[model samples]
Target: MNPPEPAHTPQPDVVAAMRGDLADWRQWLARVIVLAYAAAAGLSVVAFSKLCDLAQQGFASVLAFNPWTPLVWTSACTAGVVWLTRRFAPAAAGSGIPQVMATLDPAVPAEARRAFVSLRLSVMKAVLTAGSLLGGLASGREGPSVQIAAGVMQHARRWLPPHPGISEHGLLVAGGAAGIAAAFNAPLAGVMFAIEELASRLEQRSSGLIIAAIVLSGLMGVSFFGNATYFGTIEVPTLRYSMWWPALLLVLATGGLGGVFARLLHASITGQGDRLGRWRAAHPVAFAAACGLAAGAIGIASHGASFGSGYGYTRGLLQGHVDVPLLYVTLRVVATWLAVWSGVPGGIFAPCLAIGAGVGHDVAVLCGAQADASALIALGMAAFLAAVTQAPMTSFIIVMEMVGGHAMVLSLMAAALGASLVSRWIARPLYAALAQAIIARGRLAPAVAAPSR
Candidate 1:
């Protein structure tokens, strides 16, 4: 004690270094958590989608599925799922893409955060979206899977210590891209989608995390599902001058039709369709039941062709294992609109893909293009998706990866461009418009959520 406590003091340099180390540790921990949770989310989506597929088929089989059985069951189940969504998780209603799109906006209101992105919303989406399919709503799990994965990553971000040095927008963007990559097993498309659709300009600091998450999540998907084209082995024939005619026709048809569909869908949801949209808003439950009944009736008319996600039918057509009648395409388009219009939790991606396949088959048959059947179907699916989402790069890349269409990349790119241009005449971009609606509703802004010191 006498030798004294000469100056027991910490060095400023050492102290500053310690603080920096702690900050870094916190951020790294958050990032690690994001990656691990993303993998788990991706795996869950795969399993859940498979389960939904099984449920749809099982319910159909048990009911003996006569014309009336499918009609009654599909309608009844639709009404039940709608009730559940309305009572428990209204946010879980509708395709979740719009909600995720809202997360990337700097001007988004703080109050809207819980409605659009949260752990609770994701779980409800998983349970209810699966339940909706079991009701034969003709939807897909792939789209909802994106919102679910984003929720997981968003929740995981909360585990970080205060001041983790990550931006809120960056976290959401990275999570979304990771989700898409994992869901489709298309990592490159994930990055492209984030760049094109989510953010206007992605800063260098945030890009690394985005890439890492996509790679990690995509690997997770690959590990669980095994490497395979989404619709099975697609036979992309070598392009010829003769095939160019069909390609051009497909681009125009898919782009125009897809644009019209997008505009109609937006109009219905935003109450821009006047009386019908107003009526829907006024009587949400009854409207949902009516939509369900319409869906059931359509399913019966189409002989169940308009049921589930249209995955099997589309894949069958592409693999040349089944013949697709034009009536099937019309019924699917009608079914999809009815389901989406009902304010039920569903996605347009798989249904659109199937519709496009049906369109392609019709085009091929009508035009007598024997050699370009596979190419036409691929072109339609890619082009229609491009037109609907307006993220042409992501659309083509995802279709390319899923269908193994690298040999026809030029054709695919052309189709996407054509579709995008035509779609522009139909309406404002879909996701951007929906995101703005969320912002206007919530009144959140960039200044509301400044980084905490």
Candidate 2:
């Protein structure tokens, strides 16, 4: 039988070549899966933005018909949303940043992380955030977007190639950064946020994955929202050293306020030492209604300027197209605090920017820079965000991209750094503190219920 063609044995070289080809194919497949995930994340964020817009429009129509409608409508909406969230997805409450942070912690249990980032919680987050906006709550979608996108990424972990290198922590970072990039159409800011706020090292193997995800999602945002700057470009003059004083003033004022806001927010959300926190914990739904009533009153007093995420108001202030009262900043801050403390799902990002913009305007007037308030406003935005997040690099980069204020890059960096330092003196890192609290709560939850059983 001609020795059966040497028993059809393949050479060592041939076998090795075949194995190499298979490895290459697997790598490419993994890449494709990551790309697909990035695209899905972008699409989800765009859809969420559209829902928020529609909700805001409906609320605007209601306000047009009767400015006082939010009094009852907001209270009812808050009560319903609070009840639904507590019943079905208690993890979906607040801005969602802490939940995302908690998931990245290695010490947190897999089960707790899974519970925090379930698809069900993500869906509820999107719907209830829209509900909050529809009721004219001072909430933003940006923070919730991070958690939503992370949830999508976490869910996709089951489909990934079973490789030790592809850790859940890396996926969470990529997903959350992609959310920020897609939400604001700022890709670089997304990368910086991953490094600074999310505490991602961008390990060699996963670095390419993180960047690719950001690019794809950001491109999707550009495709839908166009390549224009988020807040539109301004005609800022060349920065002179003499004009730096206003930035310093804003650093102190905005930073101080931002620190206070972070402290109060953390206390309220965690129910630490504040009396209001105890009340909210005891009767969440009823307390939400009361908070809503207060928000409604603030909105009425501010002539609707304090409603929604305050995006339009901030843009108006930046463009000098709208005029608000001296107490606009105060009202916006209080409104944001109440809306968040009510136990609804929303973000403080846009509301904080609006508050910062108002502060910028006041500073500009004081410093006699009324002729060009855009730069000061941009500085205030960066400063307050940095102070609140304790992430100066990410804050400045995001502000720069949002306003297209490259000319003021140095000033933005300075303001952000200065404000972050000042805020550090007043409060702990807001998201990290909240994240640790989440982990502690998760650890205690079973024990707390075990006694009941």
Q: What lDDT tens digits, residue by residue, belong to model 1 across residues 156-194?
A: 666766865556677677667776787788888878877
The parts of candidate 2 lying over 4 Å away from their true place are 1-22, 443-453
1-453 per-residue lDDT for model 2 (tens digits): 555455676567977888885777656676777778888888888899999999999999989999889899989999999999999888899888888887777666678788888677778899999999999999999999998888877776777776635578887888898889898889898888889888647778878877888778888889999999989987786677868788788899988999998998888888875677778788999999999999999999999999999989889989999888759999999999999889999998888888888999999998998876888999899999899989999889988999999988988899999999999999999998888777666542343221110
RMSD of each: 8.3, 7.8
- Choose the strongest candidate by lDDT: 2
Question: How well does model 2 score by local distance difference test?
Answer: 0.86
Please give the clash total of every predicted structure, in order: 4, 0
lDDT of each: 0.77, 0.86
Give the distance in Å from residue 252's predicted Cα in candidate 1 to where it truly belongs. Answer: 0.7
Residue 282 displacement in candidate 1 (angstroms):
2.3
TM-score for predicted model 1 compared with the true structure = 0.89
